[model samples]
Target chain A: MPHRTEDIEIGLLLEALYQRYHYDFRHYARASIKRRLLQARSHFNMSSVTALQERVLHDPEMLPRLLGFLTVQVSEMFRDPSYFRALREQVLPHLRTYPSLKVWIAGCSAGEELYSMAILFREEGLLDRTLFYATDINPEALKAAEAGIYPMDRLRKFTENHQKSGGKSSLSDYYTADYGRAVFDKSLRNNVVFSDHSLVTDAVFAEMQLISCRNVMIYFDRGLQDRAVGLFKDSLTRHGFLGVGSKESLRFSRHASAFSEFVPEEKIYRKREP
Target chain B: MSAPPDRAVVIGASAGGVQALLALLPSLPADFPWPVLVVLHVPADRSNVLAGLFEAKCSLEVKEAEDKETVRPGVVYFAPSDYHLLIEENGDLALSSDEAINYSRPSIDVLFESAADAYGERLVGIILTGANNDGAAGLAAVAAAGGVALVQDPAAAYARTMPQAARQACNAALVLSLERIADYLKGLKAE
Candidate 1:
């Protein structure tokens, strides 16, 4: 069968992105990425992916706009309550034994998961001892995550999720809602270090007690996914926890043997000692 | 009869979807040549049991679609509740947690549009009983890609709005009852 011209254009565009900007999305899961690129093409009012590629290659301003589309940022605080609940009831007990803890929130899009973890830790009396490394490839997202503001309307769902995750404190204690925006408490992120990092192109930077890299790797192809899992295995301390998305699994990954399922239903794994 | 031998089928439904799927999917023979992908709107907060529910009834293999898994013939893949399922050009499955479209995360439009891009003319898109218009644009995309578009007849559908909107979106789509749609699929031959 003949290859689609659009697919060819997408390949060229991804290649241009990597060679020009060093943002490697060339190994992302193709279908969703293609859909996102098409959305970007339409958003830019470009006639085709080829035209979009040419424009982005020449104009530096267009790269960030395209990056916004390429990066998946849709997230909710305590998005999957059950996963948080599992972390609270099962994982935290093991983590509490350590005097100091480093938790890595990989792909911390807009700070939802990071904030959720902070609140969970605070409630569990682990806040002062824990340091969070919130990282993402998108600088814009990292900045927003650091700012820690969200629409006020979303708080209801967040509150419900908080309660479901066995929240001990009122969700209202964390943020001040005003004029359709909720500004989260600054102290919640006092120990957080937000930085620009890409699981696709970056290496492990810290030895973490818990690494929550949820939903981010769903966009990766198998090879990239394996690379990411391997990175997680390397970053995690022996018997430390690694939590993936509820739907994502390390079962088929080459690095699967490095971690054993800790809470299999919640997709939480424990790094095995070498 | 004019359908391509190496075709794939995508079906979208909501509201009365479970019953419609049970009635339709079990009719496929064990040796059915093409893979069947289905999306049904369900609550996002809970685990999806749709695959298990259908596995006992359907003759073909039934499982939830996993990210990056190769799409195989003779299997029925259901989109997980909280994620949108898409088909890659190489026929692998991809899942997305992007913002919901038409108030649904596992949006039928997402799946159908991606499948149309993947399979093009060798794809069959079906819209069944649903109260919402989520699949209208998707079925139109399928038709635009030269794929066969099938809509459950509004009069026969448990909920008529979805089929009505889909029919309006694609004038060329065949409007058949659930039974007739199954018969047409059963008539399809392997490549």
Candidate 2:
């Protein structure tokens, strides 16, 4: 089939973005990319994607603005309580045997999932022994994650989810609310590192015992999903754990055989020892 | 009016969707030609049984749309609850948990607009019984892309707001009764 006009324009745009900005969305699922690009076009007051591409090529400042559109930033603390509960009950027991641990929260948007894991580790008495790596392609989100502050209004739902995840103490214990912002204790960040990492272009930086890369691959095309899962396979220690979103699965991934279902209902998989 | 040839059907419903789906889907024969994709409003927290329920009633194979799965003819694919279903240019399915649009995660507009891009004139967008106006703008996108737009007649719908909204937004190619819509779908296979 011949490429649509918009499709051609988008192809060039993504190529230009990669060449100049080095942010690769070329292999992302096409429909969502098109949708987000169209949104970016309208937001920037451009008539067509071609015009937007021209501006993006010439103006470096437009990169972050467009990245804001391309990356999905919506997330919540302990978004799925059951997944965390399963982590605490099912996966934590296995990790307890390890003298020290590293947890990689891939695609850790705005620090919500990272904070959830951090709080969980602290509650389980594993925080001191654990090194947390929270990473994403979005620098803005990384900055936000490093800040560890959220608007006060979101605390109610966060508290409920934390409680549901078998939280050992009040959610309030981790944060102090003042002037409509909840500043999570700096102690939570003592062992955590926030960094800019692209699953598409970047390789495994460290071997990890637990990698929670939830909901990020839904935006990726099959080849890209395979690449990320392959990285996970390479990055995991022997019998390490991997958990994805409720709806995500390793069944279709090319690397499926590398992991077995640990908490099947929660989409959690464990690396199989050779 | 006949469905456009080589077209796919994208249907969206919210309140009273199950009854509407049952009334329409079960009537099609075993070898329905065009693939049917549906997005019914469901809570994020619960497991969706939409495919399972439809499988018992419809002769067509029913399953939830998986990420990057190619669109297959004669299959009925339900948008899994809490995910936006999109059709790629290559006619594969892609799922997104991006923020909800128009207060809906599986927003009819998202699916319809994306399908319009993929199928163009070879698409049929349908709005069924629902209490919300989620499908109106989506049906309009289908129409704008030279695809057919359909809506259940408000008076005949169990919940009319959705169809009424579609009527107000787009000049639908057909305002069909549930039985007529089923008959129309069946007629496509004859061609």
Candidate 3:
């Protein structure tokens, strides 16, 4: 099939972005990328994607604004309660056997999932021995994740999700409600590190006992998904756990041979002993 | 006359959609040549059993759309709950959990707009019973892209607001009852 003019322009834009700023979005699923670029185009008051790309290539400030559109930032605490329940009931027992633990929350948007995991660990009596890494490519999201605050309106759902995930203590134990914001307990951050990382371009940062990277790889193309899965395979210890979003699967990944479904319905996989 | 061989069918519905779909989807035969994509509003926490509900009744195969998967003819692909389904430039399916549009994750507008872009003139967009106006602008988009737009007659719909709103937004090519819509599809297959 011949490339449409707009598509060729998008290719050039992604190429320019990679060569100029080192953010590789070339392998993102094209449909979402096109939608986001169109959004960036309108937000910047540009007539077309080509104009937005030209502006972004020259204006350093445009990169961050466009990054907000290019990357998805939707997340909520314990977004899928069943998956958390599976983690708490099925995965935690095995994790408890480890003398120490390193947990990686890749694409940890706005710290919701990180705090969710931290609170879960605290309730499970594993917080003290666990080190957590919460990483994302969005600096604004990273800053928000570091702040650990969310609107009070969202807490009701979060609290309900926590209870459903088998919370041993009250959701109130993890945060104090301010005027309209819920400020998560700083103690939860004691063993946590927030960093900028990209699954698209960055290499594995550390060995992980459990890696939860949900709703991130759906935006990637097949080859990119394979690359991210390969990175996870390389980053995990033997028998280490990997949990993905409910809709994701390792069954089709090129690196599928290296892992087995640990919780099939929950989309959790465990690395095979090598 | 038969619809073009390259034509793709995109359908969107909300409240009372499952029943509406039951009345419409079972009519298409196993050898239907056009791929059908559906977006129905579902609760975020609920699992999508749309495929399961239709698989036994419909002649065409029904399954939840997967990320970046190629679409096949004679199949009915329902958007996975909590993910926005899109038609990619390469005529494949893509899913996203991006922030909701019109208070919906598997938004009708998102699917219809992308399908319009991908299929262009070779698209058939239909709106059925729904309470909200999520698919209104999207149906307009389909019409703007030179695709055929159809709507359920408001009097016959389980909920009238969606089709009424779409009627207000665009000049739909046909506004017919569920049975008539099924007959129209069967005619396309026969052609």
Candidate 4:
């Protein structure tokens, strides 16, 4: 079958993005990326993806805007509350034995999961000893995450999720509402480090006690998924916990044997002592 | 006229979806040649039991779709409750936590549009009984991509707004009742 003209245009666009900007999305899943690029094309009022690519390549300002479309930022605090609950009830006890803890929130878009983890650690009496690393490839998302503010409307659900995750304190204690926004307390991020990192291209930067990289891998193809999981395996300390999205699993990964299913239902795995 | 050799069939239903699916799906023979993907509006908070419910009654294997799983024939893949299910160009299934479209997560449009892109003219898209206009644009996309679009006859639907909206969106879509739609599907040959 002949390639659709739109698909050919998308390939050229992705190539242009790699050649002009250092951002690499070539290994990302094709169908969703194609949809996103088409959405971007429509938003820019361009006739096709090639036109969008031409504009992006010529105008440096368009790179960031186009990057926003290429990277998915959809996330919620305490998403799949059961996963957090499992961390609280089952995983925390194991982490508490360590003198100090380093937790990595890989692909931490808008810092929702990072904030969730910080709050969870604080409630569990582990925050003071914990240093959180929040990383993402999108600079806009990293900035938003560093600000730790969210729309006021989203707080109710966050609060409910926190409670459902067996949060030990009031969710209100962490954020102040102002001008239709919830400004999370700056103190919550006292030990947090926000950085620009890409699982697609960058190497692991730290040996972490817990790494929560949820829903980020679904965008990657099988080979990229293996690379990311291998990085997770290498970055984790022996017996460290790694949590992924509820629907994602290590069952198909080549690195699956390096970790044991710590909480099978929640998709939490523990690195084997090597 | 006989239907083209379809590589896959995608069905979208809501409002009275379960009953409609039960009536339509169980009629599929165990050796049905193409895969069937379904998107039925379900609440995000509750755990999905739709796959299990259908598996007990259907002849083909039925299960919730997983990320990166390869699409297989002779199976019915139901979109999970809170994630959008998409078909990759390589025919692997992908799940996205992207914001809901048309007020739905496992949105009918998301599935149909993606599948239309993946399979092109070798796809069959069907819109069953529903209350909202979610699947209308998706069926239009299918028709635009040269895939067959079939809408339940509004008069025969449990809720007419959905089918009526779909028919309006894709004027070329065949308007058929539940039994006729099933018969049409049964008549389809493997690619």
What candidate 4 gets wrong by more than 4 Å, as runs, is: B1-6
Q: Each candidate: RMSD to true structure? A: 2.5, 2.8, 2.6, 2.6
lDDT over C-alpha atoms for residue B49 of model 2: 84
Give the per-residue lDDT of model 3 (tens digit) for B110-191.
9999888888877889999999999998899899989989999999888999999998999755798888888877777523
Q: Give the poorly placed runs of model 3, Cα more than 4 Å off.
A: B1-6, B189-191
Question: Of the candidates shown, which would achieve the greatest DockQ relative to the real structure?
Answer: 1
lDDT of 2 by residue, A1-274 (tens): 4687989999999999999989999999889989999989999999999999999999988888889899966888988899999999999999999999999999998899998998999999999999999999989888889999999999999999999888998989999988999999989989998889999999989999999999999898889999999999999999999998877888889999999998998999999995
lDDT per residue for candidate 1 within A81-160, as digits (tens), equals 99999999999999999999999999998999999999999999999999999999998999999999999989999999
Clash pairs for candidate 3: none
Candidate 2, superposed: residue stretches over 4 Å from native: B1-6
What tens-digit string does per-residue lDDT give for candidate 4 at A133-166?
9999999999999999999999989999999999
lDDT of 4 at A209: 95
Deviation from native of the Cα of residue B161 in model 3, angstroms: 1.3
On a 0 to 100 scale, what is the lDDT of residue B25 in model 4? 99
lDDT of 3 by residue, A103-172 (tens): 9999998999999999999999999999999999989889889999999999999999998888889988
Cα miss at A208, model 3 (Å)?
A: 0.8
- Report the candidate with higher lDDT, 1 versus 3: 1
Task: Give the TM-scores of the predictions, in the order they appear.
Answer: 0.97, 0.96, 0.96, 0.98
lDDT of each residue in B37-86, candidate 1, tens digit only: 99999888567889999999999999999987778888999999989999
lDDT pick, better of 3 and 4: 4
Two-chain DockQ for each candidate model: 0.77, 0.71, 0.71, 0.75
